[model samples]
Target: MAKKPKTAITPVRSDNYPEWYQQVIKAADLAENSSVRGCMVIKPWGYGIWENIRTHFDAIIKKRGVQNAYFPLLIPKSYLEKEAEHVDGFAKECAVVTHHRLEDDGAGGLKPAGELAEPFVIRPTSETIIGESFSNWVQSYRDLPLKINQWANVMRWEMRPRLFLRTSEFLWQEGHTVHATAECAATEASEMLEIYANFAENMLALPVIMGEKTPDERFPGAKHTYTIEAMMQDGKALQAGTSHDLGQNFAIASDIKFSNQDGHVVHAHTTSWGISTRLIGGIIMAHGDDDGMIVPPKVAAQQVVIIPAVHDEADREAIMEKCLGLKLVLETISFDNIMISAVIDDRDEVTSTKSWNWIKKGIPVRVEIGKREIEGNQVFFKRRDESPREKHIMPEDEFLGSIADILLSIQNNLLERAKSYRAQKMKKIDSLDEIFNYFKSEDAGFANIPHSLWDEGLSEKMKTDFSVSPRCLPIIDGELSDRLIIARSY
Candidate 1:
C-alpha cells in the first residue's frame, strides 16, 4: 500500500467535507469568530475580497440608473406591523430593543432602564422603513420611478452560525425601486436577477442556474422571486442572490400612492433585490480544493506575489532588489480593466514557507525570484488553477507582456470547470421515488424534476425524510420553464 500525500488542510475534503470547509477559512486567514455570539470578525484579506466585490457591483448598478443611498439600521415596531406578511416572515429572527439606556444597580451592576413607549427592531430587511421614505418622496407622476441602493449591515438572529455563510450581523447591499407601472417593476426585477447571474459567472467565476422560486419559497409580500442558485463541491446548493417583484403589496402597506398622468391616484409597483457576504462562502465552497482556496483572478486581492529565494547571505540583497523591481513592473500592467496588484513576500523566512502561504491565500499567480532565474533573465511562476508542483519558465519581458492574458485565462478556466462540474452532478428524474433513492447516498447532487410534481405534501415529506427542497424552476432562454431543480442546500 502507498502512503497518502500530505496536504495543507487536514482531514481532506473527501474524508470530512464540513470540517474541511472550516479548516479552509482558518488556513486562508479569512475570518474568525467574534466575541459576540453568532457574529464573525472578517480579517483584512477577506475584507479586501469583499471590497472588490462591492466596487465592481456598485459600478454595474450605477450604470443601470441606480442611485446609492443610506437608511437607518433600526426600524420602529409599528413600521414592520404595517406589512403583516413581511413581519410574519421575519418574526422569529427579529432582535428588538426595548430600553434606551442602562442604569446602575445597587450591587454595582448595570440593568436596563428608560423603557420606551414603543420598541424598535434591528432590521432583518429594510422593506418597510424604505417604503415609508418612498411614500413621502413620491406624490406625482414626475416622481414615478425612484431607484435607490444602500450598502449597510443587517442583523438577523441566527440559530446556527457559520462564519461567512450565516451570522447574526452581515454586510450587504439592498436595492429598492418604485415604478409607475406593474410591467416596469416586473422588468426591473428580472433585469436585476440577470445582473446577479452575470456578475456571479463572469466576475466570481461561479456558474449558476437562473430561475424563479416556487410560491412557498417567494419573498415575504412578494408576488414573484427570481434567484441564481449555485452548487457547491459538497453536492449542496447555495442561493447566491435574489430579486423580488413586490407588486403593490409594500406600496399599499406604506401608502405610497401617486397621481398618474390620467389624474388617478394609485399605489406604486415596487421591487427589492440584494446580495450579501454569504457570496464569499459560496466562492470558497465552489472553487476551494483540499489544498486551499482557488480565487478567480478577477477578484483576487493580490493577483501576483513574487517570492525571493535567497540561499546565501551574498544573494539576499540582489534577490530582494529583483523581487521589488518585478512588483513595480507588474503593478503598471492592467488586467480586466484594473491595474494588477502584486506583492513581494520578502519576509525573513524560507522560500517554501512564503510560497505555501500565498498558495493557501489563493493568489492567482506566484512568481519566484532566485539567483538562477535572475542570472538567466528568466521568470519562473505557477498558477493557482494548476497542480502545486506544476511550474513554467519564460523570458522576463514575455511574462510581463502576457500577464493580462494569463489572468483572463485563469478566470475563464475556473468558470468552465464549475460549469462542467454542475453538468455532471445534475440529474433529470421523473418520479419522487427515484429522487428519494438518489438522495439516499451520502454525495447526492441536484435532481431535476417536473415543476408540476412539487406540492405541499411532497415538500413536507422531503423535509422530513431527506432534507431536500426545491431550489428553483429554471428559466430557459428568457422564459420560465416547468422543470424544477431540487437539492439539499446550505
Candidate 2:
C-alpha cells in the first residue's frame, strides 16, 4: 500500500478534522484557552487578524453613514426583562451581576458582599441596552435614521466552548439603527447582509451563501433575520454574520417613540447586525490545509515574511541587508488600497524552521534571500495558497514590481478554491428520506430543498435524526429564492 505523506498538523484533516483544527491554531500561535473556562487569550497573531478585519469593515460601514459609538457593559436586568422573547432566548446564557463588591471570607477567599438594589447582566447582546439609549436619543422624524456601531466584548455562558468558534466571552461589533418606516428598516437589514457577504468573499476570501433565516431560526425578537453562511472544507456550514430587522419590536419594548411627519408619536423601526471572532475560526477551517492556516492577503496580519538564509558567517551581512531592503520596498507597495506589510524573520534559527513558521501563520508570501540569491540578484519565494514545496525564483526588480499582483492572485485563488469546493459538495434533494440518507455519510455537505416542503415536523425530525437544521432560504442574483439549504453547522 502507498504510504500517507507526513503533514505538519498530525491527524491530518482527512483523518481527524477537529483535532487538526486545534493543532493548526496551536502551531500558528493564534490563541489559547484561558484560566477562565470557556474563554480564550488571543495572541498577537490572532488579534492582528481581527484588527485588520475591524479596520476594513469599520471603513465600509462608516462610508454608509454609520457612526461609531460606545455603550455601557453592565445592563440593568430590567432592560432585558422589557423584551420578554429576547430575554427568554438568551436566559440560559446570561451572566448576571448581583453584588456590588466582594468581601473576605473566613476561608481567606473573596465572597459576595455588598448587594445591589438591582442586578445587572453582562452584555450578552447590546440590543436592549442600546435600545434604551435610542429611546432617549430619538424624539422626532429628524432623528429617524440613527445608525451607530460599537466594538465590544460579550459574555454568553457557552456550555461547550471551542476557542474562537464558541466561547463564554468573545469580541464582536454590533450595529443598531433606527428608521422611520418598517420598509426602510428592512432595507437596512438586507443591505447589511450583502455587505457581510461581500466582505467575506472579497476581503476574507470566504465564499458565502446569502440567505434569510426561517421563523424558528430568526434572532430573538426580530421580525426577520438574514445571514451569510459559508461552507467549511469539512462540508459544515458556518453562519459568519447576521442582520436583524427588528420591525419596531425592540422600539416598542424600550419605548423608542418619535414624532412622525404626520404629527403622531409612534415606535421607530430598528435593525441590528453583527460579526464576531467566530469568523477567525471560519477562515481557518475554510482555507487551512493539512499544514496550517492560509489567510487571505487582504486580511493577513503580515502579507509577506522575508527570511534570510545564512549558512556562513561571512555572507550574513549582505543577505541581511537585502532582506531588510526587500521588506521596506514591499511595505511601500499597495494591494487592495492598503499598504503591503512585510516582516524579516531574522531570528537565530534554521532557514527551514523560519520558513515553516511563517507558512503555518498563513502569511501569503514568503521571500527567502541567501548568499547565492543575493549574488544572482534574485528572490526565491513560496505562496501559501500553493503547495509548500512549490518555489519560484525571480529577479529582484521583477519580484518587487509584481509582489502586489502575487498577493492578489493568492487571495483570488483561495476564494475560488473555496467556491469550487462548496459547489461540489452541495446537492439538491427531493425528499426528507433522501436528506437523511445524505447526512448519513461522514461529510454530508449542504442539502437544498424547496422551501414549500419545509415544515415544523420535518425540522424536528431532521434535528432529532441527523442533527441537521435549515440553514437559509438562499438569495440568488438580487432576490431571495424559494430554495432552502439545510445542513449541520458550527
Candidate 3:
C-alpha cells in the first residue's frame, strides 16, 4: 500500500515551477528523452495534445486555401546557399551528414569510411529548398499563387536543447507560397500571422502581442518579419511563431520569375510562416498551474474526468449503470472515453477526498457522481482555481452545452488574466539606462522605450550602446496606434 501511494503522487506545483515542470511532465505522461541528446521521444499522450493543436490549426489553414504537401528533409549544401543572407544566418546551426558507409575493422567495431563526397545538410528551415521547387512550379502569372503547407520535423542543431522549446529536432507546419505581386505576398504574410495569433489566443488559451521584427531580428532572407510573442509565467517572452514576407528575395535568388498581368517577366513575391511543437511550451507556461498542466479546453486530450465516488455495493452498481450510456456522446475536444472505476480506499474513507486527486492531475473538469447527485439525475462540476467556490448540476440535455461553455469561458478568462498580468508588469521607459536598469531587477520583462519616429540616428546609437533594437516599428503609420515594444529577444 505504501509502495502504491509512492508511485501515485507527484509534487505540488506551488512549491517550485522547475521541479513542478519535471513532475507534471512525468505525471501527465507527455514525453522524455531517449538515447539521443537534445531530442525527445514524445509519448502517445503528449502527441495526442499536439494532434489537437494540428487539427485546429490545419482546419483554419485549409479554409484559407492552403493545401497540405510534403517536402524533402535533406537539402544539398549548394541549395542551402542559394539565398546568401539565409545561408549565413542558418549555416552555423546546420547538421551535416559526412559519410554513409561503414567498414568492419579487424577489431570488433565498425569504422566510418575515409572516402566522402559533398556533404548534405539537414534543413533548419525549408525556405531555400522550397524556393527551388517554387522556381519550377511557378512560371506564368496563372501559377503564381502556389500555396502549400507541409507538416514535418526540422533539425536545428543547438548546443543547448530543452525538450520542446529548443530541441535539436522539432515538428512544425511550414507554409510556403508564391504570389504574383509583392502586395499580395505581404498581405499573405500578415494574414497568416493573424491566424497564428487567433489560434494562440482562442484555441491555445494564450495571450500574445502581434508585432513586426526589426531588421536585426528579421528572418535571414526575409525583407520584413512579423511575429507573435507570448509571455510565460516567469515573465520571459517566447516568440511563439513568425511569418516573413520575402519581397522577391528568395524569388530573385532562386529565379522564381513569372510573367506578369502586364506581359513582363518579374520576380514572384514569396512568404513563409511556421508554427512548431514548441507551442506546447507556450500553452504550458501561459495557463499551467502548480497543480500540473491546465490544458486549454480546446486542446485537452481528456477534458473531463468522471470520478464516481462509491459507498455501498448498491451505490457502486447504480453509478456503473449510469456511466454505461456516457460513451455515446463522448466525441469532443473535451470528452474522453467514459470511465467507471470501483477503486476505493481500504479504510472506506470519504470518497470526496478523490476530488483532490483529480485536481492534482490537472483535469479541467471533474464530474462528481455521489449518491445524492446520482439519484437526483445530476452531477457536480468543480473548477481548479483560487478565485472562489464553483459547482453546478445539469440535466442530460445541458451536459454537453455546459461543458462546452465552461471550456470557452476558461479559455477567455486565461487570455484576459494573462493580458492584465503583462500590462501591469510592463513599464514604458525613455532612455537606454532604463533598459539596463530593468534587466537588473526581478521583473524579467522589457525596459527600453518605444518611439514614433524611426530615428535612424537614435536607433543606430541605441543599438551600439545597449546591444538591443526595436522589436516592432509599425508599417501602417499612425499616431502610433500601438506603441513599439523594445526588448532583448530570443
TM-score of each: 0.98, 0.98, 0.85
How do the candidates rank by TM-score, highest first?
A: 2, 1, 3
Per-candidate clashes, comma-separated:
0, 0, 1
Candidate 3, residues 344-453, lDDT tens digits: the string is 22234465556655555455666666687676777666765332147777775577556666666766777787887777766677655665676555445644265644
Q: Model 1: how far is 193 from its true place, Å?
A: 0.3
Q: Residue pairs in steric clash, candidate 2?
A: none
- Model 3 alpha-carbon miss at residue 135, Å: 1.1
Q: Model 1 segments beyond 4 Å from truth?
A: 1-5
Ranking by lDDT: 2, 1, 3
**What shift in Å separates residue 475 of candidate 1 from its native position after superposition?**
0.9
For lDDT, the strongest prediction is 2
Instruction: In model 2, state the lDDT of residue 442.
Output: 78
What value of lDDT does candidate 2 attain over all alpha carbons? 0.93
Candidate 1: residue pairs that collide: none
lDDT tens string, model 2, 129-207? 9999999999999997999999999999989999899989999999999999999999999999999999999999999
lDDT of 1 by residue, 255-334 (tens): 99999999999999999999999999999999988788888888888899999898888998888888989999999999
